[model samples]
Target: MTDPVLRLEALRHGYPTPQGRLPVLDGVDLSLSGGETMALTGESGAGKSTLLHLAAGLDTAESGVIEVCGADMAGRDDAGRAALRRAHIGVVFQQFNLVPSLRVGDNIAFQARLAGREDPGWTAELADRLGLSPLLSRWPEELSGGQQQRAAVGRALAARPALLLADEPTGNLDEASADAVMELMLELTRTAGCALLMATHSAALAARLGRRAQLRGGRLCDETGAAA
Candidate 1:
């Protein structure tokens, strides 16, 4: 089989606490091929977010390696890792992370501009597809929660990153809005040929993805098949 677009091998990470170095992930391994969508499901504080952070290069692994689009992140310095993330990773967080001052259109194009890859046509298309066309000129604070989330999704996908990491992208939306956003996210990620790794608490959401994995006791395992 071809190598995965994103891979984590023997990954371990933790944060310091008064007691000790509290391990968040322990020897976790995962792989995602191009156009594949994998749902990460687990209880609260099950290291789902930590795994996503490690995969996105937002945090470092204590031991092991994270490879994105064939580049080994383990050897890179912070700047190098940042460059990789900017160029090849798209992330959506539960908070939406939209800039209050920027208009919806500007927020959608921000990352692409940062990467020197702003595509006006792509941005327009994304805005239309995400149903943000009418709100393009409005500031983030003026939009509803679903609208803000949609803008965030558009922003992350506009850059056409090789890997897409989403942490509960639909967590705050109502059922109808959540389903709509999930459909749009899945469709757009497929169109972009990106690998998707989403951490969610919803079993129904996980069932929609190509595969499902559960995080528990600081490790990840396939929920439907044998352990990876």
Candidate 2:
């Protein structure tokens, strides 16, 4: 069988406080294969975001293992981690982190360019599929919230990453816009055969994924009954 695209085993992490270290994630385990989607759900301060960040190599775990595309994330240095993220991972957040200075076309192509695998045809196809072809010439600030989020999705998928990590990607949009963006995101992830792990509070959104996992008291509970 092919190896899982992402795997976490006995993962633990915490933050320093005046009292001591405040635990966030404790012994969380998960595995995701290509074209699979899992929703990470929990309440405020439940460590959902922390898990995503650790998985993306944006932050280090205090203990246990985080493997991306069969590579141990803890084994890589800062530069190596950055290289790994650029090569195999894509990230999106509630705040659309588009480069304001660049036009929409350039913004969508940003990550692919950084990865040194920019394909104009693929980028153009993504823009068209995202319904941003008309706005490609415009700046991010000029587009509506939905339009901007669509562009963000396009940007994340521009490089055809092995894994995609999204944190409350539609939190800023209205219900209609959020649904539209979610549909496109789901469709595109399947089309690209990328593994997606999204942290979201909305049950409606979580229900759309292939699997669901809840974060509670620093541990993970698989709602799908596969594992935890």
Candidate 3:
């Protein structure tokens, strides 16, 4: 494969507990090419979210290296990592972390503005594609769950970041709405040429992606149950 947009090597992370450090991820390694969509599936507490955090620079690993677009995160400070995330990464969570005070349009444009690349044309296109154009002025509280999720997705993709991380993005939606939102997300991500690492529990959803991996025993493995 070509050089990966995001790569992790021997990643290990854990939290403090009474019994010493409770390891979450253990020696995890992954590589994602640009415009590739990979689904991560596992049971609850399988370290899916933790791995996403490490990939997106939201959290640090205990050991090993994480590289985004060829920049190693191991030696970077908090501000540096944050800057990297702002420049080349976008994340969408299950909770649809939209700012209640900002309108839908503003929320979608927020990260782009922070990145100092707020292109009006791109933002408008995202709004229209995500079906948020009619409700651009509405607040998060005024929308349905599906609408809120769509807005969150639009916000993440509007900046055209090199990497997009999504955690249980369709967990709260009904089957029909989930299918529609997933289709839109796939289309938008492909159009933007963003590498997508999505953590989901649905096998059906995982099957739809270009590649599927599972998080088990504190590591990521391929679809045929072999280590990747």
Candidate 4:
């Protein structure tokens, strides 16, 4: 059988404060396979974002293991981690980190080009499905919050990465817009058979995913509050 798309085993991380090292993630463990979606829920400061960052290889863990598509992330440098991320992972941040200088179309195609997997057909389809075709030539500043977030989603999935990580992706949108974005994200990821791991505070949104995992006391638990 094939390996899981993302995995974390006995993960631990902490931050140094005036008092000492305060633990964020403590012995966290998770595994996600292809075409699966998992919602990560937690209260504020529960290490949800920290876990996602470590899973994406954007930050290092104090101890334990992180594997993406069966490749271990323990000894990789920044550049190496970046290479792996570009090749196998996609991320959508709450802030919608689009390139201000690039037009919407270019932004949508950015990650795919970086991964050397750009396909005009797929980009065009994404633009059409995301309702951004008309706004492709417009600058990001000209778009509203929802539009900008849609562009960010397109950009992240453009490369068809094996795993997708989203941190509060709909936090900035209104109720209607958030629902629309969520629907599109779920549809696209499902169609592409990518693994989705999203960090969210909304119970409604979390329920939409196939599985739910909550962060508490630096570890993950199931919807019933049992250890995951």
Candidate 5:
């Protein structure tokens, strides 16, 4: 059997507030397998983004373990964690956070180059598949919203990471554009055999994935929890 690409064990995180430490994640546990996609849904202040941040190694958990691609996050220092993310994780943000200074093609190839795994052919193919071929030399600020989002997706995938973490990746797009980006993301993740965990507020978007999970009271629960 294939090992899970992501595993969270008894994770807990919180922030210090004037009142006290307001807990965000508590005893949360999850496992996601290769090439499988899971949707994370919840209302505002439910800690969806907090969970994604911890999984991506952008933040440290106050307690518990986070394992990605078999390596325990708890065992790694700051630089080690960064290296881990660079080598194995791809992230898409809600804001379409592309480098305005870099051209479309360069942005797509950036992470791959950092990982020392750049493949010019694959990068070009991704640009073509994403319909960004013509915009290769254009800067991100010159593109439309949909175009910018597509480029973000391409940039994330170019690294061919083992796991992909997306936070409301299509939230800024119109219905039609959102649907197209979601479909393309799934298609490419399947082709790369990458595991996906996307946090979205849209039920329709969550329904498209293989399984659904929810964050409530700082806990991670299955679809059944969505009812509670």
Candidate 6:
């Protein structure tokens, strides 16, 4: 049997402040299934990004366990974590994080190359899906914000990772562009059977994900679940 795409147990984290320790996540627990898409929404400073960072193993939690695809993140060293990320995890940040020096096609294929899962055909198909086929030779700086973001999504999906963690991926785009990008991302993830967990501030976007959870006062509430 396959394990969950992601799992967190009793997660607690905080940061040292000028006055004292500022708590972020407090004994939080969450999970996402394979091929599932979940939207995480919260107010600024509510620790949504913090939760993603911990889930991605980019930051250490004060305590708790994070399991991605059945492996325990808390047990991995830096190299182990890096290897895990390269193997099964893909991250799309708000900034698009494309390689400015690489051409658009190369940028989209970069992570797949690093993950050693390069599939030229799939990458080309993704480019077509994202409407980036015409701009594949262009540089990141030359593309519009929506195009850059589409390239970022392509890069993350090229690896065909088991899980995709997106941190406000459409936050930089206009409303129309945001809607298009979000739609494409969801479609691609579903086709590729990749689990998606996106952190966003848009309630409308969250509602489209089928499941929406909010981090409120260090607790994760199933907003849609509550409604249902």
In the range 109-215, model 4's lDDT, one tens digit per residue, is 99999999999999998899878999999999999988999899889888988999999988887898788878877886688889999999999999999999999
TM-score of 1: 0.94
Candidate 2 at residue 57, lDDT? 90
Instruction: For candidate 6, give the lDDT of residue 211.
Output: 77
lDDT of all the models against the reference?
0.89, 0.88, 0.88, 0.91, 0.88, 0.88
lDDT of 2 by residue, 1-228 (tens): 988999999999999999999999889988999999999998899999899889889898899888888888877889989998999998987778899999999999999999998999999987887678889999999998878887888898888899999999888778876787788678767887889999998999999999889898888877754446
* Candidate 4 structure lDDT: 0.91
- lDDT by residue (1-228, candidate 3, tens digit) is 466889999999989999898888989999998889999998898999999988888887889989998888766889999999999998999789999999999999989999998999988988887778999999889999889988898888778899989999888778987887788778866887788999998989988899999988888888778997
TM-score of each: 0.94, 0.92, 0.94, 0.96, 0.94, 0.93
Location of the lowest summed lDDT over 10 successive residues in candidate 1: 219-228
* Candidate 2 structure lDDT: 0.88
Better TM-score candidate (2, 4): 4
1-228: candidate 1 lDDT, tens digit per residue: 777889898999889999999988989988899999999988999898889888888887799989998898877889998999999999998888998889999999999999999999999998998788999999999999888998998999899888999999988788987888788778866787888899998989999999899888888877754565
Error of 3 at 78 (Å): 1.4
Best by lDDT: 4
Better of 1 and 3 by TM-score: 1
Worst 10 residues of 2 by lDDT: 219-228
Q: Which ten contiguous residues of candidate 4 have the minimum total lDDT?
A: 180-189
TM-score of 6: 0.93
Model 3 TM-score? 0.94
